[model samples]
Target: MPMRPPFFALSATLVLLLSIPAQACTLWAAAGPDAGGGTLLSKNRDWAPDHVQILKYERPFGGHVFFGLYAEGNNDPGIKNGINEKGLSIVSASASSIPKKMRAHQPGKRGVIRTILSRYASVDELAADADRVFSGARANFYLVSDRSKVLLAEVGLDGKFSYRVVDKGVQTHTNHYLDPKLAEFNVSIGQSSSTRQARINELLTQSPRPFTTEKFAAISRDRNDGPDNSLWRNGKQHTVASWIVHSPASGPQKLRVVLANPDQPEALHEYTLDEAFWKKN
Candidate 1:
């Protein structure tokens, strides 16, 4: 009896499919008068095992900055992303897997995650370090924004970093990287990616005109729609993994923060801006 190649070929195809990335993460951004807010929603069997903490940092380094919304503790603090003293916000999303052959240019020096936060105080500053910061690291997508600008950084494990300035009048991002210039990593292979993207698009279309904080919050809390259907069915849609809103100030010192347990709905935390908060001078 002779073996057939068909069976082996089918087995190989199945294995390849199974090895591909399979996870769903969604984010929505909206700007308002002196304020902007959004949501971080995700669902995966093995998401990062981390505790979300909100810390208020005081003077010397940067006065009254909130730190560590979602983070993993290791050398230099693995902040998945967070907001800083200047109301500058940063968020990173996982990209496709990097090939093992890629060499690590600077391993054990200082984790790329910590170096970015400690060194760069603004989005522009971080943009300047994008090349060096992303080298020799696994593929990942980052969103950095301040009151005036929003930028996206896409980095590959091979040490390639691509930058995109969001000038679409308004910009939004999800888990998968969104730079056409980067090597096509085929993010569409993931069923969740397409589904979530469609859902986000739908929400964006339905969003009200003259976007306001309340409307933006509504979009973030929207779970009855696509992408959120699974979470809604499981009765966990409202229990937000994390949420953030950035608004401009009316005077010299003006900023606001709204934090809440989406799952609870009623439970919410709020903060107002102060002159001494952003800077002492």
Candidate 2:
């Protein structure tokens, strides 16, 4: 018998990135044959339970019309994660493994994520502007995807960066660096990072094929590591929101968002990337 990739397992690993402590997030993406002939981009936004978050939309002057998760009352340049009209989507997590002292400047110092979401339409375009976009930026690991490709990027506080295209299998990231050069500076504070990373991957490998948003949502709610360190965190830093974006090889993309707080029950919202939806939102 030929080997078949555990489809849902790849998406399950994406939720693991959200379990790390501090104001961190979990991000993962799956594409090609392993992704059930479509692409799945997922994230669990971990932060203080008190911080309010909302879905933000924008039609930047001449750039892509897009929307993403944002802290309420914030007037930031970009969103936590979102997909543009061109079908490009980006999600991120802190590169906590890289110490602060080594940072040439604050991570997201130049608001790179916002710029890319507002202007670029694909990983290839982002790559073409790599020099202009990342030259002086600080830390963060970004996962970019379009209808057919997925790319993982690590931006160091020292102004260094690396990116790899994940053309197959499921790829994931937590609050650590996976790039060899960046990993050398790894000084992760606790086991939360490594443990979550492992747990998510384990879930992905054991899961059945043909991924679905519901399955990924189940992974995001995982409390296998207890409240503090499970994929669905409940310690000082907890999950505020979760997102799952399904981009198929053909057809309009779709999104599902779950907003939550330790003090309240979760609220779910869904959207289809169609002309009417964009016009209405």
Candidate achieving the largest lDDT = 2
TM-score of the candidate numbered 1?
0.65
What are the lDDT figures for the candidates, one per model?
0.46, 0.76
Query: For every model in order, what is the number of clashing pairs?
Result: 8, 3
lDDT of 2 at 229: 75
In the range 170-241, model 2's lDDT, one tens digit per residue, is: 888888887777765465545767778888898888888767777888988889997767788878678888
Top TM-score model: 2
* Candidate 2, poorest ten consecutive residues by summed lDDT: 6-15
Clashing pairs in 1: 34-247, 34-248, 35-247, 35-248, 36-246, 238-262, 238-263, 239-263
Superposed model 1: Cα runs more than 4 Å off:
1-24, 31-66, 71-78, 96-113, 225-240, 249-267, 273-281
lDDT of 2: 0.76
- Judged by whole-model lDDT over C-alpha atoms, candidate 1 comes out at 0.46
